[model samples]
Target: MELLPRRPDRLFPVLLRWMAIGMLSLLAHRLVFLFMYVFQAVRLEPELQDGAVASVLKALFVGLRFDLATLTIWIGPFALLLSLTAALYALPAARLRYRLLNSLFFHAQWIWLLWLHLVSVASTYNFSVNGKHLGWEFAAYFRDLPVLLAGSFVKDPVPTTMLALFIPVWVGAGFFVDRRLSVHAGAADGHPNPGRKALLTALLSPLVVLIAAVVLFRGGLQQNPLRPGDAMSESSPFLNNLKITGTYLIVHDLSDRGDFKTFYPPEENTAFVQRMLNDGRPFVDPQYPLLRRMEARRRMPGRFATIAGPGLPGRPDRQPNFVVLLMESWSAKFLESHGYSAEVAPNFNRLAHQGVLFENFYASGGRSANGLFSILTGIPDRAGRTILRSSRIFNRFGSLPLLLKKKGYQTLFVHGGDLHFDNLDTGLPHLGFDHLAGMKEMEDSGLYSRRWTMGFHDEDMYDMLLRKTDELYAGAPERPFFAMAFTSNNHHPFGLPDPSFAIFPESDPEAAFKNSYHYSDYALGKLIDIIRTKPYFQNTIILIVADHSHHANLDYLQDREIPLLVYAPSFFQPERRTDIAGQLDLLPTLLSLSGGDSPYAAMGRDLTVPAERPFAFFAGGSNTDIIGMMRDGFIYYHYLRSSQSILLKGTHPVDMRDMQAEQPQLAVELDAMTKHYYQFARSLEKENRIWPESISE
Candidate 1:
């Protein structure tokens, strides 16, 4: 066939390309879908949803495989646009005919799209699921997006469907477009060029084949990390399926949570305690059980030196209205602006000047829940698992809200996301919250006009919180106020809510986190403005601290740590103290600052006014592998798996002796106290107690 791009032959190639693309797309979607579904079914027993097996089957089949309904929905608009635009490309005046052009264009489009999906799926699945970034070594697994989808298969299936759709359109569109476009009449005068050049353009066909192969591989790897209620383990049925089918060849260690231990005293197998304080050797005779138990139960002096040595006399003047804004993903030492203002938060700098900003406050855990537990409860997380999540298993925590409620304070717990998503409803109110307001509760309220997420905008939430503050102060003159506010926009997939007031710039981040930071600042500003206008500003002591500081799965905020901003009236001069602290110290700090003896002795010291052992602990659970940190700056990050440690100059490692010493000390004074807290909380949870005079813990 001596062709110069004839129409009949061209159409066949276009159709072929589309078929291959579709097969490849749907195949990959099914692989990831089935993988996640199967993983959850075998590894976890999710209490959130009803039928695990059915949901898994639905996802494995309808959700992942041949989501024709969604495929059409996504492509329908693009198809319309392409068809309209093809009119121009198909016009006779155009030199390029649709016949030879469409296939190539579609192939090129698919390549770009596959890369985008790769990034998306990878970012989600491969993420560390830890607190945030660490230095630069974050969860850069090019595979997080797929992993986090384990249990939350039903949240947004569009991404999976889109991946399926993208593969085919990308593959087929180019070929089809080219073939159709080639029909334009390029007369024999100029277009009389021989057949091979235009027709043999399929020489580039092998490139497409390689791309198709990668797409197939990509699909097979995606799995959900949040396996509904169950944490996934190595023995997942999905992994077996992958092995049987020979679909996916590699399985990555998606999370550091696994290798780490969560229970008290770390894992028995690990040598962390032995290595840290024991000169990298076991304290016991290696195989002695009794000796190991003896070694493990010991305690060391937690506060080596002065956390905060007793010093200044009490401020004779009334305390200021403390507003502690714990910026998400923030660290006290990390913000470059603290060193050189050219690169970091200007608003923080301003706030630091306005109030006393403690420079060395560490987060209690690598998670928001961890920070909240520490700040509100003052008790560090048990050896593993967050106190809030582990409450059903262990003891429920006592919140600052509850502690303050006894002192005549009406408490409010507010956040921009769902209160019950992570059992905040079960936990928060148990801690004595008078009101729990989250995105679900923001319905029809002006506080949340925009809705990318179900939660109200931070600005809107702030507005609502301020109004509530006003109402409480105006009407309820008898009770003091305690409010815990959580900002959400700066969270992962950090897309901006409003660009006009963008505080942080985003040349580009997968998520525009800078914008979220800027927004957080604005929310704080709004809060401050409200405080200025109200009388509560003068009397209300607001404590601002981060829920936890992490950027997505990697917590880079370790340096700056969480900030402790206690804002009150000018009566309390902004006295900057070098008392190092953590979220655990918030309660005792507040209680001490209030000059009232606590109902129950606090694990956290009176950090607000400064006391001995100024630093608080960032007790890492299994997720981060880091263990206790002392206020005197002794941090112990037990790499639970390897047992290898890198002791920064400031912190010391917790050895067998330390554990031996600390455990008994914990047992002696704190154990009974801690147990009482749980007993009290259980009673409160059962009795429908709302800020009762005393819960008894």
Candidate 2:
């Protein structure tokens, strides 16, 4: 270096070669997905007929467009890097360092390609289970990959273990291909001449390539890019799916369809939807179609005449304050009211006896997001989709907070954990909450828990809630208040501040869960005690419900069973209702209890009234598409993918897989119920009328 450093070689030529090779490797990666889909199709089919052959050919053609778009987006950043490398390598100096950089980028491309193929392969299985492409809406909830992987292994260990073994072979093959193609990437070359002709060509070449990449990224000058539905020309949904690659589908979903709304044709299904909306109910006008029926209900003709009146007929004129407590992981599994271990939740038992408890209540899905969305939106959770914290589509929904705000109520959402954990922070405000507070707010108030992840203990949260409620109501005594509080101390890595609160020893997970459950119950008792001492105690109503069951067996009633306790001693009767109910029923019930006369669109009927359909619909286990209908004393399950159904008698510790064979006739009932729920959801999305305030053009 003391002497003049040796001039490096020309850079543009090497960069060009690298870009071409990367494009080829990306094409190869796409073929990997194609082959996997074909492999699954062939295995599922005994022989490939002419129809299948035609389907495959068309799929390949349609798939290319999607693949091209994916490649374009994937290589945009890489292209920029290559352009910089090209200019630097063209310089007489720094050529060696640039060559090394090129090689590293080459290796990085192969690693990324390997990851893409792996995800593509795994998605085939996911599709098989749910009969839907795995999209970004579903992927957004993959926050805890380790836990998800472990749960998958526990569900079916053999398949996961085999996939793990094959991953190395796939990655190694990609590495080998990268090595073969990039052999000349680091080779030294003559320095580029500084002539105007050479400089112009170098600049123009990358510019042209970049322009082409941009066009491809926007998907070939079309008004809109290719979507998942674009590949649905085939008669068979399964064959139609073969035209879509998993990676392309996920990318397309992320780009468009923010809420993951279904594409089912609502106009054609108007009559079907009309039947579902009424179901021979006395309150509904059977002559009207879906939207017309909703309009009719909004009128609430002649004194809100119905079989069941709004909650507490004696106090209908008084608008009571509402507080909904979404207890974490508080499945009926741990509730003594549901005949669990008697020592588990003494306070809940006492509370349930003093109020109305739904004996057949169930959560609509396994996740907390499902319960939260259904409870607040009054809509059934869509199968195989997550809406909470999904920034693209949260504000689209009609929320309870928005409805209550119209009625002069102060709306608040409180959680002991980080509100931003699942995108709740953005979503809650959009839902019409005036105040959204979480762990940060709790800590600021000097209420912090050392044993908890987000600091504030369940006891502290409840205590703070009492104070906050006082302040909110005090601000405007004329305005009623509605608040939702979520507790997290009973969740995984469950713990309690006071060891003496545990009735059972923390020797195992179930024991530890019970201990934490008891402690939460103790905190709830404290909150209730404070409420009882308040001046507005008689005019206040508290609703206790679980987000979802955690440790319950996936059989009939046990899996979806959750407690729904309505505590309003001055108004509602202290009797237990045995009709089937779900999280979706809470909103309409709350509105009725509030004695609000305004009409609203709700998928669930008012639970304060008698249940029109004595069946609760819920999705459980690993597959969300497996819809379950719990009615009478049996649970019927319908697998939407294969149109398979199984009936399991209501009992504890029964295996769902080992249940009785398909009931073809009863399967129709389950199908109708599932379709009805989705039809309503799709109709709302199509009309863009989830809330009464939403204007539909």
Candidate 3:
């Protein structure tokens, strides 16, 4: 007897048809991703542009795999149901009922395809605006949908119009495609196979589809499932982003939210962190692991020590006033002092020669919020969450502003943008800011004529800083002040009020960015000029640093590297320090320089004091979960999710080659050290132990 029926089964043709639709849907996703890649490539750096063709091909190949995985997830259940319905069609009695059900499933696939295309278009627009695919920010954007749409129309009308038109047009095309592909499922043959054979085929077909679906959903038979980081083969961030589908990013980021798991015991993590921070000194209290009483080491005798200034209060020593300029997107790579060919920050370069400049300084994380959280609180930015936006913002801390308040210094936070953005208005005050100012305050002043998309121009913000400083001194001239002004003009979309500052031609890809940098530098020069004329200028110390680097096609180390200048010519001598430091060190270093001996909790050490084992810990990568440590002429990167680590040698032009295999022992040591810091940070934040209100408790 024949092993199977001579005629083809009805289920076979229906299953093949469904497979064809699934493949086409996947292909459509690939094409949309290709469009995003090309759109982003328009702004690629010269080096990245040189290898664009090869990178695009590689990214597309990787993107295709992710697309398959995403599509399988989206259509797996429907496909299984269709398979069972088709198998049932092979039965003579149930043919009519199964055909209707099969048709319904096919239409459902068509609707899902339409929705996928719409999401793809929306993600393309999102990439253009934010430089990445849709992620957790989708929820924030959705909540602000009305404002976002209004801004999109006003600021980016071209892409907005195209995306708006795409919806209806794609929906019409979907309808047309569905109608054209409405062919009926194959009818059952009069000569049916034996009932046993039909039932066996029906059972076996769904099982086969289930197995295939499982394999595709996992992307292969690998020991581990595919991840967004797996697509990170290229050094260019844009290329890595292109290689992963939006569906994967959204799901990955959403799932990773609020999941701060502790890998080690609290005691183990606390002990490691305490040892690293104590510098061979004893902890002030056993109840608080990170708390320690630090000595006030004077770097150099200033005029206030001998002159008995107004803020001296019968004591010869008076605290120095602080002016911290948290510059926006001021990447070290764009400064002439940092080896850039262009003089994007001439004022910064001129001032760097008058004070101590940290040549190897890096930001604690990528975002402005990360820099603020790290620099103010002396705590490293936690992976997978921005502390400012999280529930931990309510936690007490030994923040710079709070410590300064204890020293009889007036603390203020000013920004050129809305203080409400990033929850700064509430978080800063909760962290002990005596006063807060933003765009509304500047606008209320009626200071200028022009404004940019973000808010006031850099010059306007600098002017406001001057005014705010004067007000603080007028109210309490005897009290030293700590005022932080965060700039916004150098941010994305690179808006500038004047075009004369453009360093390159409009045709140049980075022309807008160069112009914004130039204008912001000019504003800095203006601020310094006004400050120099003030009587208290000699007693004030200015700290200039970037919130984070601009988003460029750069490797991990290059992206976080930023300039840190402590400018007080009358106090500290001019010197360039090559020591490794990060944003976390700012609070302790500033507090040390301010000459305060109070007990405080800080994860970072004072940069003014030489470190026995110098290292800078940072949170980075596309998802911000990668922990990196730079020490002993080597950089170690550990991906927390995958437990993948790499060791690279050198700093300038960090050699991307993995040295882990050759230096296995060093890698293991550095990896353990890095994880200790990560775990301790999470533990401290979770337990509210960074700085308790009362150490005795």
Candidate 4:
């Protein structure tokens, strides 16, 4: 009677209904995540902290006032869409269990979206400042692969874990809606119903298509993403244009490390693709040999000077433990007139008082990596990439440190971020360093930012640095050592550390710069104190320089323009140097200062004494390079592409084209210098050798 109340039939339909609902919800969830990826392409990295969410919720208590209306402008549309989607997802389902399954599906989508946001932040925020393509620098990360695969193996693990976590959340949300909102809305149909059969058939083909699309798209974007040679070939006709534009972009991106006003359209983007492609062309000609190198001499003066070698580093009678501190984002203009204000480094000011301060020292490049390359190798970044990226250029880079090590100086490098991020770990050892230290190398990894949104707070870096100083210099036969310290406090995301947290700024950019400088100074003071305790206090040489200009604050000026100050406890204190010098001169100058033999093919003359040449710094591109040269109490700004030159007198701009054109011989001489610089760089890259014995001034 009553059809025997067939329980098996009822149970079968109920199960089918749940299975169908789960599949549809999963599909919808994945669709939302795809749009999130599109947002990242334009550099909108959304922050997702539980704390930030809490702050927004608390603002609700502030009342529905007109003041809150302004907050809606930016996120209003997206917020509305998300709300509508959430409401749709919360609709009453046919079965209780099915609703719960659907909720878990939606939550998994959120986990996927979060992973994309993290990557968008990581790549853009981290600053290396080399005028080269960042995409090809990594051993991992193909443009075509799933973003998670583009990163390391570990990068995808957390997202996978989060997806697992979301299943429970999704199931619970579905159950809550079903029991509370849809209990009465359900029909006589159970979990296993005809509805489920239809749902499965509807999605099966599309689902297969979706997966195929992901694979096909990735394949189209990058045929093979991980291989280096893949970057050498242009991906499209558009990419050829991207290469030519990159040369212009390098001046804007790598040098000043600032967004230029797109002097030409694809300024930064073009430069972002130059993976050792010297402005759409390779730096080294394929057939070039080490013996017949330095051929890029006729192109430009900057290239010429860059190719010429600084012959034989002078012998170090007693090469003291040298510590070259490359302070990040520093300005040289502050030291020009009244000296850096309390707004900057007081200790550095004092150090300048005790040391030989290059009043007119200029940085060859506008980036940290670029300036470092110029300083260490005494060659410009004409290789179209960073020295770290092209380790195969020579068996050893410059050999300045390796030679010093032979002279008995232990060498070490210290940086704020992970050294491997830019391949510093792989490349620096070849640069002749005995050791490398970065945030990862430190034992006390501070709770700076797990994400490092702004990167490791400079104060944390300074603290970590001090703790590791002894370990870095441990048991080194008591000979002089060369320690390179890179400071990052003044860098990005611009958040300051608390006084309780570390000795950082009280809260303004001016204060932040001062805080960072102070922290670095204190660390220097501590290192100096250690030197005082050791026997090398009087014999040690400390060179304080900036890797690049403080691009964040243009008003601070002197960005590519920098100061070079050398401090020795009692060795030599010339006090002030009016000689013109660029970062390319650093190696030769230091070698001369330490009395070491000059290396082969260093274009820069020694600046430890007066430099006979004008202060020249080149911004590269086929056109539109901002070349600033100094001569006779005047700074000349020349547009290399357009052949425009200006000599600003005192605080006023003056047309110096005719005046500069007067120096035909000087122009010819500078052209030769630029040629030499390129020749040397090409030699290293093509021949994989450096000739120190056959070098000449």
Score every model by TM-score: 0.49, 0.62, 0.63, 0.51
Per-residue lDDT tens digits for candidate 2, residues 1-697, read: 0001112223344444534544554445335434545666666655444466676677767766766666665555555555556556455575556546655765575566556545644554455554544566246535643454465456546655555445355445545654433434422233444456445544554576677677866558764444444555343445555656566667655643423434346554555554555534333322223222121122122222233344333432257789999998888877776667667788899898888888878888778887888899876665555555322233255567877787678998888887756567656776778897888888777655453754578888887788788888788777788999999888877777877876775566477777888888888988898899987788788999999877544345566788999887876668878788888877766776666454455666676556456666675444666666666566777665555767776556555653454455555665666655565564554344565334331
Per residue, candidate 3 scores C-alpha lDDT tens digits across 255-277 of 65543556678788788778778
Sort the candidates on TM-score, descending order: 3, 2, 4, 1
Q: Candidates' lDDT values, in order?
A: 0.46, 0.63, 0.73, 0.45
RMSD of each: 16.4, 17.7, 18.0, 17.4
For model 1, the superposed segments whose C-alpha errors exceed 4 Å read 1-324, 333-337, 342-344, 382-384, 391-396, 502-511, 551-560, 608-613, 621-623, 630-634, 651-697
Worst 10 residues of 3 by lDDT: 303-312
> Which parts of model 2 are misplaced by more than 4 Å?
1-72, 76-265, 268-270, 279-317, 449-451, 506-509, 552-556, 620-622, 640-644, 651-662, 686-689, 692-697
lDDT of 1 by residue, 408-490 (tens): 67777777777655557656776677887777777746445676553666777787677666676677755567777787776
Q: Once all C-alphas are superposed, what RMSD does model 2 give against the true structure?
A: 17.7
Residues 1-697 of candidate 4: C-alpha lDDT, one tens digit per residue: 0111112223223333433333333332232222223233223323322243343333222212211221122122222233333233322353344434433443453444343323322232211122222332222233423443334224434433444345455545554654433323345423344344334433342334334334432223433211122122221211211121121112222442211212322323223212212321232322221211221111111111122234323443245567787877667655422345553456667677777777766776666767776777765664244444432322334456755665567777877776654456655665677777687655355444532443565555555554545664555435567777787765653344555324444565456555555555555655555656755556567788887776655431244467788777466634676666777776665555444443323445555333344445444322225544444445545553454555443122333344445655655444433333343453344333444323332
Sort the predicted structures by lDDT, highest score first: 3, 2, 1, 4
Worst 10 residues of 1 by lDDT: 290-299
